[model samples]
Target: MTALSNRALNRALLGRQFLLARTDHTPLEAIGRLVALQAQEPNWPYVGLWSRIHGFTHSQLTTLLQDRKVVRSGLLRSTQHLAAADDFRRLRPLLQPVLDRTARSAYFARNSAGLDTASLVATGLELLAGAMTPRKELARRLAERHPGRDGRILAGEVELRAPLVHSPATGTWGSWGTRSAVSVTPAETWLGRPMAPVTAKDLIRRYLAAFGPAGTMDVQAWSGLTRPGSHR
Candidate 1:
């Protein structure tokens, strides 16, 4: 077997990431090609798209969010990401273990001690159904139910437990890293469908294609899924 040189590897990775040259693909297409765009901040996904897509307009992506063609939600290591609305349905369920792990982390556990996770998620889903709810308002409502628990902490845990997406206005282009207030609704409600089931093998294949070949550690780090090799 011929060994691939470092330069060749770098080029391949660049091409796969759409960093080698701008492509004529639509913003939505580019988003699909990359699986998802890193979008912790409102403007980050716009920057990511502009660098990869030729003639990419800020409005083009903003429009996708406004039209509900795309969503900004917690994905890929339980951080915010931008993915096509249809794709989000497929991706969210497969990556849910990562979100579960995040919820069980020390910070959330400490703050939300004694909170019933299953109940919190169920209530959260109920609160968001058929309506866009502000984060503070949702938290306040939840605090009333959990008496003495921090509203923000309870709300944050629910975010990890259930599928949620930010409102279009909350995800629009902005200079700030994060908004002081965010409005969200259940993902299933916004997309008008349930989250689709996907397998670990499928998740690994998609990750390799979008992220290029990688070691087990790399896959785990990027996706927050432990023991990626076992997915083989």
Candidate 2:
């Protein structure tokens, strides 16, 4: 193998990420090419898209969410992300370990020291059934099941433990009018489709296509995914 320089890798990332210049690709196409979009703040993906796609509009993404073409779920660092409905299934399962490990950090660990993750996830699904729920409401419901624990902790854990998608209306731009708003539904119910199945080798290929000429650490950092036999 040949050694690659940082500048070369940086340029490649910028090109693939569309930071080099806007592209004429359709919104969904652009999203698919990138593999996933950062969406910790629901609206940030809109901004991220705008910066990369030509003639981008909020409606494009919002419509995708509403139409069940795209979904916001826990993947890529256990953070909220927007991905094609088909991508969420494979991506979420691949990311579950990362999500769980991170959730075990200070945020959820303190308040949820003894909580059963499986039960918490079930409660979250029940609370979100037939409705979209913001994190606060989801957390509150989870807290209901585990009295005396912080709702925020429950919400965070539930998100990490289960397949959930941010609801369209709440994820729409300005939906909450500047408040921290997030409405979630189960991933399957939200997408009205099943998640995709992807293997580690396949994920590696996809990651490289989107963020390639990358070292193992770069790949790990971008997607919250890991596999054995990585290069330094």
Best by lDDT: 1
What stretches of model 1 exceed 4 Å from their correct place? 175-178, 229-232
Each prediction's TM-score versus the true structure: 0.94, 0.86
Estimate, for each residue in 1-232, the C-alpha lDDT of model 2 and write its tens digit: 8877888888988999899999999989998888888876767888989999999998899899888888877788877688887878777876777888888888678888877777777777888874777788887777777789888878877777777777776556766563356677777776666656666677778888888876677777776767523311
- In candidate 1, what are the lDDT values of residues 1-232, reduced to their tens digit? 9988989988888998889999999999999989888888888889899999889998999899989999989999999999999889988887888899999999889877776788778888887666888889889998888888788888888988788998898778983643657888888889889988667777778778878757677778888888855542
- The number of clashing residue pairs in each candidate reads 0, 1
Q: What is the C-alpha lDDT of each candidate?
A: 0.85, 0.78
- With a 3 Å backbone cut-off (N, CA, C), the pairs that clash in candidate 2 are 134-182
Report RMSD for candidate 1.
Answer: 1.7
